[model samples]
Target: MSKIQKIKGFSDLFSPESTVHTLMENLARQVFGTYGCQEVRVPILEKTELFARSIGEETDVVQKEMYTFADRKGRSLTMRPEATAGVLRAFIESGQCGAEGTTKLFACGPMFRYERPQKGRLRQFHQLDVEVLGTDAPQADAEVVLMLWTFLTKLGLKNLGLELNSLGCPECRPVFHQRLRDFLATIDHTQLCEDCKRRAQTNPLRVLDCKVPACKSLVENAPSIAESLCPGCDEHFAQVRDILDSAKLPYRLNDRLVRGLDYYQRTTFEVVSGEIGAQTAVAGGGRYDGLIKQLGGPDLPGIGFACGMERLALLYGQAQIPAPDFYLAVLDSRALNTALLLAQRMRERGFSGEVSFEARSIKAQMRQANKLGVKTCLILGQDEMEKGQIVVKDMATGVQKNIGQDDLEQALGFRKP
Candidate 1:
């Protein structure tokens, strides 16, 4: 016999976990909608080139974390390791940018990233992503960050820290990069990781993101690139700061806070919490002003952020999602048909309920309902069925009452009893 087990880095979501996901999705959607962001669902898979071009090819996500494979026709494909690239691909592919004014879209979906699984990190996790396209104003950057901060605050995640930085537009970034490299030269290379050593020669900016204790200590006093921003980038960063002040959201400026993507330009920020270990970036995003044009779309600037739902859920405490309020259990063969019809009607009328499909005895059915945490159980037995009525039993109070079929909704407190 073979051992049955879930694959490493993956686990199942059953019952309350599934309920929690639904509630989170709905809550995020509601919040995004309130801010005039419409929901969009993108495919879970995309051409491998999409990410390679959008997220830097040198980044760990594309080089180490992406789940890529070849399909029957020998075309290389990959599950979307993140949502922003896929969202950008959709905007271009669907000609959404050409539609009209700005495009404000939100997406909630499963994102794939291969990494060592931990408490809040999973191989198959979810992200709530928000993107605004067709603007390059610093105000747009501020609004998006402000919106995210407000949203997270509303979710009761009060302990998060906002780290902000500006990567500067292409023309000014090279100057900062040279200065950064010069400063890094003073540090010993022996203390850095092999990857950081290699990155130093290639993508030197990423060397600052090193997590090793020795490397962290070495780079602690490194010069801030945000302080070196040229006139244009300087004004942009200032305006973003002004907006944050206006919104009364406190933030720490970190010059080394560059996003691990080449396409990202100008403003970049991350919302992190120390509650989780090293990968504490609960949400991160920034302005990718050149990304739209780079991806074969119109010359529109875009800004957005992606929040890891797993991390947020963990930090906020995973209160069990509520179960259905009522479970309608029918007894006797004659009542089964009516129970099925009633179950459908109850749901259609905005009631969370279920009816037994099997011919279980009344006691067994009631037991199942109690196990489900149902507060109210609808009983359909021989006497009630013959009298064209049902019994509404309050499981909590152990009170029962006979009500006609038409009064069922009213009995459940849909209206005055």
Candidate 2:
């Protein structure tokens, strides 16, 4: 028999790493709630057509990265590479669009993709997704961006930069597409990377997002999308900028920041950190006004963003294991029940405590308490039980004190409930 191992590109989060994940999710729940956003739980697996239609057939996610397969019934299914598409599907199927004019939702869960794994980039990763549906106003775009900025700052991420761009709308994108295609035609196709070459013919805008050094240089002098925007898109982009500026949110206007997704339109933004190499974007999203309607839903506009939890964890520095409020050590097997009851009382009083489950010597129990880094330990033994009292030891200072059983909660600095 062989020992089982975790699949490549998949990871097991343990100890302090799992603790950091919990802290991030808790903070997101609070911050997103403050902004009037409610939680939405979507499935991890969705129909293949959902992503194919929403994310576009030609995008890298659909062509290469997506974990797609055929089910037993010969129905094509895919594990979601992103959350927005499934969220919109749920909104439509649940009839939330008719009930609630606008929906503000936040979701946190694992998303799967089949890409080569690297630092901060995993095949199975998690995201904190936020979306505001049923609005076309640029203020919604600005508000979503602002909410992301506030969330990141609250997470103790510092020295972050916001990069903004506009990909124009259906009415104006054709003009820019033709101009970009003409420029690419002039350059020898052989000089470009294979992906960029394919993208130039299929979706010229994606070439701007290519990271290849050669493709990047070629795109540096490519026609700017800002210059080709029609009046509607231009005004929309300007208003988004004005709102961000009025709020004193500093951002750089990068005309080339065409996000990888095919759904983005009008306003696109990414929050970046220099601490992470190469993959600098910690969070990115934009206005996808037509996404809901495109996915067989009502004509509802939506804007949202998603931050890679792994990338955020990478920048979170060292993980700090949380200390327990108390550790209950039992010296004699006969006093186990008493120790458990006391520990439960402490927990109900809002103190986190752990009771010894195994019958161990006093010294061994003390060692376990120290290993857990608990601040205080309540020692329960036959002697203490007979006297109707307990021994309290402060792990930090090695101080010992005796307290009546009834006064245990007060001695631990907890008010009686």
Per-model TM values vs. the true structure = 0.92, 0.96
For candidate 1, the 10 contiguous residues with the lowest summed lDDT are: 408-417
Clash pairs for candidate 2: none
Please provide, for model 2 over 232-321, each residue's C-alpha lDDT reduced to its tens digit, 9 standing for 90 to 100. 999999999999999999999999998988999989999998988888999999989888989888888899999999999999976787
**Candidate 1 regions off by >4 Å?**
1-4, 358-363, 403-406
Clashes of 2: 0
Q: What is the lDDT of candidate 1?
A: 0.86
Every model: Cα RMSD to truth? 2.4, 1.5
